[model samples]
Target: MRRLGSALLAVSMFAGCGGLETEPSPESLTSPSFESQQAPITTTDVDVAPECKGIITFVNTATFQTLDAYLPSNVVTNLVNRRATAPFTSLADVSSVSLVGETRLKQLEQGARARGAINSTCVGIFDGLALSTSDAAAIVSLVNTIDDSELHDVLPDAWNGAANLLNLRPFTSAQAISNVAGIGEVSFRNIRNAATLSRPFEALAAAVNAIPSNGSAGVQLKRHFDWWNEVTAQHGYSQGGPTCFGLEPSSVPYGATIRPYLANSAEVMAEVQSTLDYVDADTKISPNVIAAGMANLSARTQGRSFKGCIFSYADDPWSRHNVAIFVDTVNGFSVFSETWWAE
Candidate 1:
């Protein structure tokens, strides 16, 4: 088995030969070229007891008759701005509104659970990723035990390998919610059925929609791989990414790219794989033509496909973040994506 380091060394040498005319830093790369529309992210933390009295119920939290005094004024205003006439079905829907992220949603959940009469409001949804047994069990128990909240047969099917995903925390991103190791098409259908059963939880459907099914290409593939050839992806997606690698792009290919490392090892691998892909795609280019990319050894080694990497990090949500797109032979994804913390 060739170590990951050997692959990195192979790719690094390719990058050194005039890959970039300019290097990107956090500052330079702040405005992302390929991200979705921009929204302000403000984190507001609210503490609530498990049981308490609150005015707005989470199941239909959009119509908070009286905003909690505890909620920051800006948050209340933000909610009001997003809500039109219909009451909010769940916190997840509220999150769809601009500027509402995980922090504000949690604050609302905590307060609503304490004060509102509706107890079945779902706080989080899981896609089909791994989960620890206990966490999986907790969700399973919630589904089975709830009256209209019945997850019933759905949870068990999704729980096939709950033990593997426990520490992974796959629920964090839209792309992360997949049936990779835990849930499957059956479980997904089960959940969808439960939602249609006129369950008490209005949020279940939205959470269900978050998962990808029907043999859809994985969601994160676009972020890292679309621009796998940073040389082309650097131009921006709307501008048209490279359709072909030209068998072998030049040794000192003009417009070929050498990007600064994005943030962590997980991100670097995406770029590495992109580089390797270009080399492998063209008969003229040899693996020996690759180079060390990004900042350091850890950054370059992150893309080693020998590790059996299968996915890339969920594209960073914050618009200020940077992305590196390059090509490689095998797909490179990160195991630590579950543990990645935004600085």
Candidate 2:
């Protein structure tokens, strides 16, 4: 096994003499590029309380008579006059009306609950398990269409995630929702379960049976690669080697073939070692190469803590290449490592 310093030096020397081909600019392995890609995904800073279904209708759409059911006559009259100018935009606005306060708000909430307009459970998650597929689908639908304020009120801890979802609106699949920052498996599951209790989400849920599962591992790996390519292009790094290889995208030889495979951490480690041994046998490369590669990979990954995949590719048969992509399914933290041998 070689130290990273020596391995990197060897790679550079070999590359300069045309004796080996490897990823360029190992320092680029840091996550700045990935972080930069997040800029366009969240464009909003507005923060307002969400409007629950029953509360929204009560304040913005209910008749005077309907208002009378939940409030004193004087308060109803006040609310009616207020609505004549403009419909309330949020629960806070409703609360601000003359003669309405915490007690009145509670009345409204209770009334809505009694009439099936809202569910108490919608405000929080009580279950620890993942939501059912239908439940998850319902939440995804709500997240896709709900305004940022509403989402904020519904999922208070997910303010940043909600903003991201707003920019990446109309999420057609669960995987897309899960990929958003600040939304992890637990949060998603909570949202799903909580959404099942809300009238609006329930209505939408009726039409959706399940949120689409992220495709197989191979599909996900390809998606990650495609995302990297897109990001590199957008950031004006298209002329550089592939980011997966810690180099600009342009470093990938034209027509180089990439094949992705689903693998456990153990499988990925095994393949890495095998590739290193094969290369060493063929070219007598540095004894530390395998150690350096393994160290690089381990440092970048979370071992069994996340899902992993392997991509094997070659610009030509004489060269061996592998990239391991790891995704923290819980939080959507994705990272990759590239190891290659070239003649």
TM-score of each predicted structure versus truth: 0.24, 0.26
In order, how many clashes per candidate?
A: 39, 12
lDDT (CA) for every model shown? 0.31, 0.42
- Work out candidate 1's RMSD over C-alphas: 23.8
Name the regions of candidate 1 deviating beyond 4 angstroms: 1-66, 120-343
Model 2: weakest 10-residue lDDT segment is 3-12
Query: Candidate 2: misplaced stretches above 4 Å?
Result: 1-54, 60-69, 72-74, 89-93, 96-103, 113-343
For residues 1-343, what per-residue lDDT tens digits would candidate 2 score against the true structure? Answer: 0000001100001112111123223233223541232221111111111213334443544556655787899987887678667655444566678888657776766654454443432231112221223444565676766543335433555667767887888876555676688786446644553344323222222212122322311111111122233322332222233322222234333333332333345654464455334333224333354344355444433353444333455555565445555443232323344444556
TM-score of 1: 0.24
- Residue 179 local lDDT, model 1: 46
Q: For candidate 1, give the lDDT.
A: 0.31
Q: Residue 110 in model 1: shift from native, Å? A: 0.9
Q: Looking at model 2, how many pairs of residues clash?
A: 12
